[model samples]
Target: MLEVEQKFLLADKTALLDQLAQLGATQETDQEQEDLYFTHPVRNFAETDEAFRIRRIGSENRVTYKGPKRNTVSKIRKEIELAFESGQSAFEQLTEMLELLGFHPLRSVRKRRTPFTCQHQQRAFEITIDEVEGLGLFAEIELLAEESELQEADNAIIELAAYLGMTHPIRTSYLGMLIEKETQSGSD
Candidate 1:
């Protein structure tokens, strides 16, 4: 499926939460997520604009494959995700298998995310408040759509972000931002 998502840096988390409440958004899941990213040994995923991430949230584990962004304005991409109930053990096994098969582990990202959802004019949208470790607060509004419905989803995301008082738009991923910050500071 196509994952149509937009992210912005949140200056005030409380203010956004208040806005979401005013908009009648209901809290969905509040969880901490740890993601481990890997690179193919023979291919450069960064150059190819692809990502392979293994994520653990609470007692569940998932592996996600994200294709390149389809547009310049929004983070619309092709994504496939699989969930398993085996938790951390499965995650470790997967990591070991990937390493053994030549996939290189990159880095791990940790974040506490609380997701909220509301319906506008019968269409549903998800708003996630993310407190990423070392990355600060971010708000993301996302919807899944077909390739043909991307414009509609993008328009909706823009409207929702504006309503929530997001003045600065951030299209970069947390991983990219963190890497850039570290690189600029000359720290690993």
Candidate 2:
């Protein structure tokens, strides 16, 4: 599936939350996600602009692979995700297996996310407000679109962002921002 989304740094958290509420968007689920990123032993994911991540949310876990962004304005990418009902022990075993198969652990990103869903132009969009550990607050508006619905999705994202009074959307991923920060500070 394709994950098409636009991200923004939230200047006022409470005001945005209130705005979403006024827009009649209901909170669907709140989650704390710990994402463990990996790279192939012989390949650099950073250089390739791809990602392989194992995410643990509560007792549920999933592995996701995200292809490189297809465009510069929004995060339009191909994604494959699989979920398992196993607990932490099974997650650990899977991690070990991936390690044995030559995937090296790169970093872990932690965040608290609350997702709200609303309909616009007969299409549903999910807006996720994230409080990333060590990174502060951000908001993301996402619509799952097919290859043919790309333009429609883009328009809807822009309309929604404008409706919410969001300007200056960011194109950088949290991982990239963190990496740049580390580079500037000269520490891992």
User: What is the per-residue lDDT of model 1 for residues 67-141, given as tens digits with 9 covering 90 to 100?
Assistant: 988665778889999996667788899999999999988989999999998887566898899999998989998
Q: Candidate 2 — which residues are off by over 4 angstroms? A: none
The best candidate by lDDT is: 2
- Across 83-123, the per-residue lDDT of candidate 2 in tens digits comes to 97669997898899999999988788899999999877798
In model 1, which residue pairs have backbone atoms overlapping below 3 Å?
none
- Model 2, position 76: C-alpha lDDT score: 90
Minimum summed lDDT over a 10-residue window in model 1 is located at: 164-173
Output the TM-score of candidate 1.
0.95
All candidates: TM-score: 0.95, 0.95
Give candidate 2's error at residue 54 in angstroms: 0.3
Each model's C-alpha lDDT? 0.86, 0.88
